[model samples]
Target chain A: MTVSPTRIPEATVARLPVYLRALNSLLDSDVRSCSSEELATAAGVNSAKLRKDLSHLGSYGTRGVGYDVEYLRYQISREIGLTQDWPVVIVGIGNLGHALANYSGFSSRGFRTVALLDADDSRTGELVAGLKIRSFDELTAIVHEHGVAIGVIATPAAAAQAVADQMVSAGIRSILNFAPMVLSVPDGVDVRMVDLSSELQILAYHEQRKSTLQPDDGVVA
Target chain B: MTVSPTRIPEATVARLPVYLRALNSLLDSDVRSCSSEELATAAGVNSAKLRKDLSHLGSYGTRGVGYDVEYLRYQISREIGLTQDWPVVIVGIGNLGHALANYSGFSSRGFRTVALLDADDSRTGELVAGLKIRSFDELTAIVHEHGVAIGVIATPAAAAQAVADQMVSAGIRSILNFAPMVLSVPDGVDVRMVDLSSELQILAYHEQRKSTLQPDDGVVA
Candidate 1:
């Protein structure tokens, strides 16, 4: 049966992935039910916040009881469109691209890396974690054959835009960009950046502030 | 003179890195001062939210006059511990680590990838992005000599834990992990993970939802 759009908030949508991971971990342990507090604790979030997040998915838990681990997992998974497999293409077989190619998380969910493409002829025939690097010319054919809608750009900053342009032309509408540059995608396409140093800089900012605001903690450590 | 303590919320602390990056861009363009509205917009955040975030660092901006671009930049840089360079050790000389070693952001942010350590001796003599790879056994000595407090674990999931364990023994307390596995760090140490596929999976969830909800948005091409 088809499901209607529930109009979940962006904030709630972002947290769904976290909850889903936690649920899967719990399921691995054979957990049948989990209270909001329990699941939230395991997920490294507050119970109140966890319940509020789940409320966006139309109240899957009871007031007195908690939630069935598998049921909630299924609900969130379906809502996230993970019930079906998503074939993906990776452009730029550099260091970051190699890591993405060998990444276990992609294969964990229904996401699969259908092809690995690189413009460099030297890397084209090299084997990376079992997948032989292919040339960028095969992007369109591969995407059409694999029905790839998700494209990952792990190329260097200089080549990011070119890869993104080619991806869009090949009917790739969703892009996960690792290049430390701002990508301007068209209206229908979506781009998400995972900047490594940026995340560390953020942590450093907090650590810096913590050193000042809580002198005792820093000194003792 | 030593700096006094100042309190900053965890959420605000996280966004400080983003603000710093945006401000640096503005500075490179020779922009002097910016209102919360302008700065927030450039940083992909709202004015009110940005103001609230800045407020945590104690009224750095004038109520009506906005913030001095250079002063705020310094404040944020200092807050993120960039006033002093942090020496980091990368345990993997693979593709992602190589990109990071050559990345301009780290060199600019007072962070140096002091040494590249790998488990394989054959990968040892090879130079990547200018730095030569060394054995993982060198992690402790290099950390001690360079006073490295932050370490990056870019090895495969199977080897990430051993690398982290060695880092801790070397007195490194902050870690930026790019491995896909869940890391269990000892108390008092902080670990941050960047999973490429997880980010894509998250974006895919949103992209799939968007396509299903707005099927009327035809392929313009």
Candidate 2:
């Protein structure tokens, strides 16, 4: 079944992968089918929200028997476009880039790190995750050779915008940026940033609230 | 002035950091004051939402003159508890852990990585980002000595739960998980997960939609 992008909300689209992961775990554990509540708990979401999200993809579970684990997995995977492999390139082989290159979850979810490119001449020819690091100048050539449409920027904040400019010029349509900086890309190019510091800051805000509310109930012993 | 957590919505709390970051950038560039619209654009948010968010913190921009950049920065930093240093311990010193230790953003904010713990004996005594990787058995001692309340779990999915359990037992109330698995933490403890593959999958979903909608409008060269 083909699903149109307009039919699903962006928030629902983001949660689709979480649901897919939970479904995959169920399938791995030999679970043939699961109710909406069961799937929601597995996905770390509430049942009502899970049902509403699945309804966007036309995946309402059976009234009593619930959802077929394998069928649901395939549907979610196809919806997230994981059914086809996506050639991805990492620009900047720093510590963060090294971690991204070594991440095994990428391959399982249809992302293949076709090339690891770095601007530093010293890092060139170095091997990470069995792949040789290439020069940043080779970006265009490598993108063309591998049909890489997604580029991951793990460079420092100072170099992020420049790297993004290079990626855009090289025709990368999607970018996953790890740099803690704002990147200005062309209109058509999509950029999603994962700011480790921002995540920690948010947690600190809540943690601060918790401490203030219960000063005597200190956890730090 | 201390702002009560109950006064602000969770969504507003999440966006406060973005606003603070934008203000800091303006401060760095010597922009003393900015209208809500200008600050909103800098933060990649809309003016109405920005105004509403800041209102929760009792930070209303002066009529025409706009907000005092330094004042807003101080308010946000204080509200998010960045004024105080939070001792943090990272468990599992692998590549991702290495990236976390090397991350300069943590120290710039409120988090300080006081110790790095690993279960493997081989990784112990090794230095990462100038800090020695200590044995996992030293977790309690380090947490107590450093007054660590935040724990980062960068271990593999197989070991995330065990690491989280140890962190909880060692008095860590906040956790930033990088493992690609669901971690079951007890009540009152907050967990924020950063799944790299999940983020990529979301991007792939949008990318797939773009390609399908305009099959001949290939950006890849």
Candidate No. with top TM-score: 2
Per-residue CA lDDT of model 2 for B85-138, tens digit only, reads 999999988889999999998998878999999999888889998999999999
lDDT of 2 by residue, A59-157 (tens): 888988999999989888988889989999999898889999999999988999999999998888999999999999999999999999799999999
Q: What is the TM-score of each candidate against the true structure?
A: 0.84, 0.94
Residue runs of model 1 more than 4 Å from their true location after superposition: A1-5, A30-33, A59-66, A121-142, A209-221, B1-5, B30-38, B58-68, B120-126, B215-221
RMSD of each: 4.6, 3.5
How accurate is chain B of model 1, given as a TM-score from 0 to 1? 0.92
Compute the DockQ of candidate 2: 0.56
In CAPRI terms, where does candidate 2 land?
medium
TM-score of 1: 0.84
Q: Which residue pairs clash in candidate 2?
A: none
